[model samples]
Target: MINAESQLFATNTSTLPLILIDFDQTITLQDTIGPLGKFGVNFTQNTKPWSYFVDSYLQEYKEHRKHFFDLPKGDFKAFVAQLDSYRSIERASQERLSQYKVFQGVTRQALTDQANLLRAEYLQPGVIDVLQEYKDQIRIISLNWSKDWILGFLKELELSKDCIFSNDLEFDESGKCTGNIIPTILTTGDKQVAIDTFRQQFKTIYIGDSLGDIEALIKADLGIIIGNDRSLLDSLADFGQETEQDIKKPSSLYRVDTWDQIRSLLQQHRSI
Candidate 1:
């Protein structure tokens, strides 16, 4: 499951400013976790219709989610404590997520058909276009998903698969998913670790959409928050107003609703 993601995208030696992004809701209009849950349900229906595994896991996730949102933003210890506090439920939730097939009760072609239908209906407009225009400069750092699924979903776009860094998904010899994941990016603190490797080499620009994204946003040389997630937006605003007295290091943060705006901003700064 671990291959070189860098090989797919290093088409040039431009030394351009880096564009780091999150997948799922940030790039697509639909979040991937929901579809993954749907896959679990489908598995039960096709195999053990009497099994309550999917339903049971969903309820467990609901419980884990209750306290997961309450954890502090940048505190890794608190985050681990939150996960440990809900370990009875949270660990199982994570296990279920760590394992799942690419398809259940369907042919690969049929799965692709359904995926395409979803793409037409739910994908964020302009994401593929903007990414395509700047393919060589982008690296995706996704938290929740395995690399295979993201690349599979975006293969039609011919996106260079070089720089996507995500957790690993294991599969059996028969291609059935195993309930084990190796996470490279685990906490909000780990985001800073991920970005540090790129900081000295490029003008890192991080783009993300949720509260989990805040740590990286603050750490990037320039950060862009997309969509109207009020919690994140307000946090950025508060960080700007309450934290600093010096005008010299004023926030280089920007918020917008569309990829087009990001394109315009990047185009204006690409020379730098």
Candidate 2:
């Protein structure tokens, strides 16, 4: 548990920096999409197999990337425009799941069970410790499909669930999934909007890892990209070309391979 005395630097606790964390590959060792798809398939009846949806989504993503890569690479505006175009692909995939009723019969208890299966195997080492230490200042902002799954995962970690903000699986009064997402967050732009809502209340440190995280990362006071993934940096290099500001500068945006580095960074800010 965090020592309450250590948080006494600020008279108004709301002035402290808010740690907005991303789920999926940022917190877990692997992306949850595939596992989540398999879970949905196991519990619900669908016209096609799980791999069919997976293949279809990948095909569309690959085609989009093929065209995206062919576009002039050095233009930041063009790069952002291209990145935002991914929302259509995301929407199409969601629509396919809804049309097929892929998760229609899943129960809340089943989601909790799936989270338990993932909790021990998927979480990145040291993530739980960092989260527990700064629990009061942390808020999970994710593009994940199920808020309940994230909540369940946090419950397993013995962490608070009050600060999660993400898209959710719709459920009926009978407590079964309705095979539709509430869609509060679907694009990088949507994430930016979520981050912006907190700007007036606290200094923001947004930590994420993906193309979808670009805007939120840039918008925050400090942005930490997890892992050594080059795709995010390579994409930022496009924006780097047109701006006077260097996107890779450590002061504004930093990258790390582990949660220990994040803890170190947060320690430096404990005095603020």
Candidate 3:
């Protein structure tokens, strides 16, 4: 296990480690996708309620899960390939949203306004302190739908906006959403690509909490899974069982239940 005694963090200032954090569930207390969808539905003039889209999306997701949920146990690569297959479900959902113009006519100002309102309610406790302490070394990488939303939310919290790297919601010249998404980081494979891009320059410590983060978490120099997400935990347990691996191995991967633990761990690295 990594613990406070590990020498992994013995490097000097010039070689400070990089922290790649997942935004949606890792940084926030919960997933904001539902709120973001409701925000868009509220602003749109669509005759259908938010439930219409949500239900449709859930149906597709359920079908997708049926085919891939068994998971390839012994082979980690095959397991990740199953996770990557989620891209098809994501694409279909995005396409349906665009088809229905679910977010069309939603103004940028409205999004920022909503973000201001959500900043306090949704942010995870101690996130600000962690972000501040690792300001120079941290990068927010997410599969969130809108980069503007993440930036606006962080700005409202008085955090750095330039550190965000996520997908974007296409907006027209009038600063209104076009109900379309630019699919940049939509899958686990895409997140791994982002991690690899940074791995070229510095040692990486990836923190995340979901199926989408599986590959990136495994690929990083150190991976920290935060929260008690049952699905994620079960999947990792399955993978570990087949491979006869221990998930608590600190040198590779570990799980924690709170940000304070994460902060303490990061501090351990810095103190060295």
Candidate 4:
């Protein structure tokens, strides 16, 4: 159902739509972090399911939830800066996670294998078709995995190089991931900065799930939301009751349950 805030923004026929695609639930069926965690667990502890690790990570960050949404925008940005610095140091030495051995050593082939490993099972099927159809206009801007991981995964799909904006992984002299993520210091708000860069140049169409994606969703000329029921519930539960109002979203945004709808919509809107 393409529910829009108003009539869909009129896009130019001569220009291709500049698309910003989210990675987690939007492109993939679920959060990439879950698979990453699974990779970590099996790589480290030889465990299956990955829940133990995820539960622990969430618990560790539970205290921060109080300020996660309520913190002033600038204050939250500053907080991420400090946290990013600290996480880089901590993850580098996280022997268990590094033992996953997927990215610890930074050979190009190893990265591709790891990317394919996850992509084979998890990547959204229809999303890739749309991307290939509009490859030139699409730019993946995700807070999901390392730049190496996203690019490598896309390469496996046989999708040629395209513009991507995301976090990076650092490697040692040996080409091993240092486990320290060099932070873009990105937050949900930073996404606005990204969309703002291109909104004027093209009819920006943003697609995402979760409240972390809410800002870009609302700010775009056309925001296509994936899984409205799930997105709102998860966002509200994750942020708190106050987020109920925030998740109501603007009319400019629309909803779709599957990626095929997105492809169909793009095909419908593109000029002959």
TM-score against truth, every candidate: 0.72, 0.85, 0.85, 0.68
Q: How high is the CA lDDT of each candidate model?
A: 0.61, 0.76, 0.75, 0.58
True-vs-predicted CA distance for residue 92, candidate 2, Å = 0.8
Q: Which residue pairs collide, candidate 2?
A: none
Q: What order do you get sorting by TM-score, best first?
A: 2, 3, 1, 4
lDDT string, candidate 1, 29-125, tens digits: 7687566446545654434322344576667768667655654555655643553354355345455444443233333333344555567656678
Give me the displacement of residue 94 in model 2, in angstroms: 0.6
Q: Every model's Cα RMSD, please?
A: 5.5, 5.3, 6.1, 8.4
Predicted structure with the largest TM-score when compared to the true one: 2
| Runs off by more than 4 Å, candidate 3 | 1-14, 69-72, 156-162, 241-250
Predicted structure 3, TM vs. truth: 0.85
Cα lDDT tens digits, model 2, 69-150, are 5667566556667777888788888888888888897887888778877888988898888888887777788878887788
Tens-digit lDDT track for model 3 on 59-145? Answer: 988988877555444788887787788888888877887888888888777777787699899988877877777866777888888
Better of 1 and 3 by TM-score: 3
Q: Model 2 lDDT vs. the true structure?
A: 0.76
Candidate 4 Cα misplacement greater than 4 A, ranges: 1-14, 40-56, 67-103, 156-162, 229-251
Error (Å) of candidate 3 at residue 166 is: 1.9
Candidate 4 Cα deviation (angstroms), residue 11? 18
What C-alpha lDDT does candidate 4 achieve relative to the native structure? Answer: 0.58
Lowest summed-lDDT stretch of 10 residues in model 1?
Answer: 1-10
